[model samples]
Target: MSSTLQLVGMGVLAIIALWVLLQLVGIVFSIVSTIVSFLVSLLLLAIIAVLVYFAFTALT
Candidate 1:
């Protein structure tokens, strides 16, 4: 009986650990995705600015 209780306790602990690990993984992925998106946006804006600058120069 004691052994059965111990097994149940261990199972519960394992489940809790798995849940926490999954949450952490999700947060990390979200942060990485946000950073990547931000960088891409900044790069696109810079490219657009450069094009605009060249266009004005060509027109002048």
Candidate 2:
């Protein structure tokens, strides 16, 4: 009976550990995704600035 209880406890602990690991991975991915999105936005703005500069030069 004790052995059965131990096995159940171990199984539950393993599940909890896996759940925590998955949560951590999700958080890391969220952070990386945000950073990538910000970088892409900045790149787009830079491109627009360059185009505007060229347009101004051509006009002058």
Tens digits of per-residue lDDT, candidate 2, 6-29, equal 999999999999999999999999
TM-score of each: 0.88, 0.89
The residue-level lDDT of candidate 1 at 24 comes to 100
Q: Give each prediction's root-mean-square deviation over alpha carbons.
A: 1.0, 1.0
- Clash total of candidate 1: 0
The residue-by-residue lDDT of candidate 1 on 1-60, one tens digit each, is 999999999999999999999999999999999999999999999999999999999999
Q: Judge candidate 1 against the unseen true structure and give its global Cα lDDT, from 0 to 1.
A: 1.00
lDDT values for all models: 1.00, 1.00
